[model samples]
Target: MSHGVNNVRSRWTLPDYKPTQKYENAYRVTARFLLWVEKTKNRKVVDKLDAALRDGTYQPEMWVKLTGLTVDQLWKEYGDDPALALTYK
Candidate 1:
């Protein structure tokens, strides 16, 4: 995701940016779950997440409220699904 973000930055002539990768795996898992949510529960969930994040009000409970799934449940359901893998073209 940071890779993609950097690509966008380069396209816009912004400075090259590198976000920390210490939580890459966590980011990937959360991304997969979000993809699942967008696929099965709410098509605008990513947008909602972005909005909440931008407002500094994002919370894990938001996922529960949106899909009735806890973080653990989301992981169990979508963690190993290759179809939801985060990919950059």
Candidate 2:
């Protein structure tokens, strides 16, 4: 009977979320892609992709092929929509 708080029994706890390898991989891929574009691709390429993302018509197949990730994975990393963001690791 030396407990500090015994008012009531509860099962509540704070969430301790951590990003998995998939998330790290996605982040790295996106960072590298952006850096590559910044170095080689012009602003127009980024602008076009931004427009496509806004319109929900973005297809990152070429990026996937180069990054060795699936379209779904790229989308999870680079998708503009919140719904798609929620699909991330």
Candidate 3:
């Protein structure tokens, strides 16, 4: 979050540049989720699904059904890549 805020602050310091509240919020959310995914060693599909849930704009239960990962296991074994995780499926 600090990284994201610093990034926006740096940009704002530029002359004639103004950052919108909406843009900052969106980027902050994205950066935080990306940090979570990367540190968890999770892949794009799961990360996208997680982001969708965190944004609260969609119900991830349907995605869980399709992807075959319960919310608990999703967060637990996120260290594994999708293909490796799928092998145990």
Candidate 2's residue-wise lDDT over 18-59, tens digit each? Answer: 233232455444443444343343435556667778999888
Cα lDDT, model 2, residue 5? 37
Off by over 4 Å in 3: 1-57, 79-89
Give the Cα-based TM-score of candidate 2 against the true structure: 0.32
Candidate with the greatest lDDT versus the true structure: 1
Two-way TM-score contest, 1 vs 3, winner: 1
Name the runs in model 1 displaced over 4 angstroms. 1-32, 80-89
**How many clashes (backbone N, Cα, C below 3 Å) per candidate?**
0, 0, 0
- Of candidates 2 and 1, the better by TM-score: 1
- Writing each residue's lDDT as its tens digit, candidate 3 over 1-89 gives 13323545455321211222221345543343334444444446556766778888667474465456544554344333322111110
Candidate 1, lDDT over the whole model: 0.59
Rank the models by lDDT, top first.
1, 2, 3
In model 2, the runs with Cα more than 4 Å from the true position are 1-24, 61-89
Return the TM-score for each candidate structure: 0.53, 0.32, 0.26
Shift in Å, residue 88, candidate 3: 28
